[model samples]
Target: MNLHSAAPRSDDRDGYLVSRRQAWFAFAMTFALMLFDYIDRQVIVSLFPHLKAAWGLSDMQLGSLVSIISIVVAAGGLPVALMADRVSRVKSIFVMATVWSLATISCMFARNFGQLFAARAIVGLGETGYGSVGGALIASLFPKRLRTTLLGAFFAAASLGSVLGVMLGGVVAAHWGWKAAFGVVGVPGLLLAFLYLLVPDYKTVELAPRVGHARHSVRSFARQIVSTLAGSPTVWWTCLGAALQLVVVSMIWSWLPSYFHRYHGAASDHAGMLAAVIVLCGAVGSVIWGVIADRLAVRRPRNKLVMMAILCTATLLVFVTAFGCTMSANLQFLLIALGGFLMMCTVAPTATVVLNVIHPGVRSTGAAILALFQNLFGLAVGPFVGGLLSDAFGLQVALAVMPAFGLFAALCFLLATRTYESELAKVEHIRLDVATSSTSPMTVSA
Candidate 1:
């Protein structure tokens, strides 16, 4: 295992891990892999309309498929994270990639809603592991100063994948049918799974001394979990804020294509094209935000989270006016693009906060738990509720509901400021107390 830190001291014998260039290279490679991951998952959204028509399904049934995948993935995150923490993270990611890729390809064989739903559920199961492991890897590879930027760039790949998946799924479905589209997009992922092995393995520094390290046990795990949670108010707040943020992010991702079709009277291809453009803008925004976030981190560690709150509030206002008002198609697209940018900003910042607060031993599990809540609240509920509201009220009315969600999210994030600061202070205070307690009494013996 390779260990890396931001600054190396003269006494440090293991200098291999401190190379920033190696870390950056790892970041780039992983970021590329992450793009395919996002593409593989999101291809479903664009394919949804085609699949619905092909299977002659209702909106609720389609929404159920999405809900099941998300809920299952959320439910599965913990176990996967446990495995990732206990085992090789790189190997875990490779396994997840392979499993999900196979599942994605299996969608081609589905002839009905039941079969298709099962495939998506399998995809979710595999993905649960991927996210936790990948996140932990990225966190370990980068230092605090660059953590947000690295994570942001890593997450920004999702936007690029989103654009390709949505656009390609649309175009492919139009020409070759949904099944073939799944086959075309899904097969490439299987190859990428093998490529995961090429990336270098890096782990966080283990503080325990060699040969005398404490062995892990259930009791220690319980203690670790409790301590980790109690120790980091920032982690919980980041989780909560991210959960609320996803309410809007999830709905938009799952249903935006449908929204464009409904409101703008767009055909499948045209709506997808526009949606791709909006997502592309979001990808660009994430990269820009990542750069800004890293720069801000030099001054304030929590600046990333602060950025999230600010962006969420700003986006909420923009969308509230755009969706609530009678706007033209052009104007609506512009507003959605703004909203997308802000929503995308949450991804990198949330990842950084979660990693920063947790211990390396349990980082994967912590990340997975975070993923679980974020998915449950954001992915599972957001789109499903959006569809339900749209069915009862209308599409526009359903979308209008998200501004309130944004406000709730912003509030959660703002409360996090105090919690995070207090928690950090407590950690420092404990360390100082321990240092003083250790050294002060020893002087008398000397």
Candidate 2:
């Protein structure tokens, strides 16, 4: 339990643990795996029409396929991340990728909706700790100053993967069948998982400094975690805000294809391509906004939270106008794309904030808490809620209402900003317990 062996062995003086080459190599491999992770998960979106045409499923049933993954991921993220913190992040990730990839491939063979649903749940189990673990690895591999931007870029892979998944699902399904798309995307992960094993691991860091105990015990471990989490109000608020914002993001990403098909009368394949454009903008927005947030905080760390709050407000406004107003389709599409960019502004920066204030030793575990919020309350809630609203009102009305959740997210970010500077001050004295060999996987969309 007192594994204080997670320090930078090779380059402690400069602050980053690994050499530049090693850092990039790790990033590339992790990024590739993350890309495929989403691809396998999301290829189902473009198949919505096919599945519906075949099964005569309702909107809720269709959305459940996406929501189920986030639900399982949220329920399971903490324990898995805790294990990764204590064991090997890299090995854990390898196994996770392999499991999810295999599960995705299994989706290709399911004969009924129930069977496919069960297979999809397995995919979520495989992805349980990936976002937090991956975030921990990248957070440790790079220098402290670059955390937000690099993490943003890393998460951008989710959108990119979703882009390909959606696009490929439509195109491939158009030529072949829906099952073929899953098989196409799932196989690459197996190769990537094997290659991921080559990435090294850092020693497990202790959760918190010991308090009055002479010997370590599970009681003490749980106690320390409670103490750490209870004291950091920033983590709680940030988690809430991140989860709320992701509600909007996930709704758009999950339903845009359906929206185009239902409203614009686009074919399934064409709808997917149109939706991919917005997702691609989100990928680009995440990185751009992350860099902007990082820059804003260069002088005052609290500025990062300030920027997040502003972005959330901007997203809320953009979406209300885009969806509520009756405009030409092309102009509405443009506004929706802009909203895509603004919507993801918080994805990377939220993780950066969590990493910034939390105890360095239990970074992965801390990140998993954030992941739980992002997955369960945000991404998990989005699609299902959208489906419900779509059924009750219509898809148009559902999309219009989703962005309003950003108001709550913004308030939480503002609340976080109040405590952000003070909490950051506390983390300043803390240092990582550097271990030369170590390993981990994480996010909203991850």
Scored by lDDT, the top model is 2
- TM-score against native, each model: 0.88, 0.94
lDDT of 1 by residue, 1-446 (tens): 12233333444331233356655655766776677777777787777677667777766676776777679889888887777666566667878888888898898898888998899888887777566678777766555556677777777887888788888888888898877767787777778777766555543233222445656577866776677765676787788888888888777777778888877778887788888887888888878887887677668766767877888888788778777888787877888888887777787777777766666667778788778878898778877888788778887887877667877777777777776655554332110000011212221110
Please, what are the lDDT tens digits per residue for candidate 2 over residues 1-446? 23343442444533656557667788999999999989998899999999999999999999999999999999999999988888778888999999999999999899999999999999999999999999999988788888999999999999999999999999999999999999999999989999997775666666655667755688888887778767898999999999999999999999999999999999999999999999999999999988998899989988888888899999999999988999999999999999999999999999999988887667888999999999999999999999999999999999999999999999999999888889887766545533444222220010
Model 2: per-residue Cα lDDT at residue 122:
97
Instruction: Please give the distance, in angstroms, between residue 424's alpha carbon in candidate 2 and its true position after superposition.
Output: 1.3
Question: Residue 440 of model 1: what lDDT?
Answer: 21
| lDDT for predicted candidate 1 compared with the true structure | 0.72
Q: Which pairs of residues collide in model 1?
A: 3-17, 4-17
Each prediction's Cα lDDT score? 0.72, 0.89
Q: lDDT of model 1 at residue 118?
A: 91
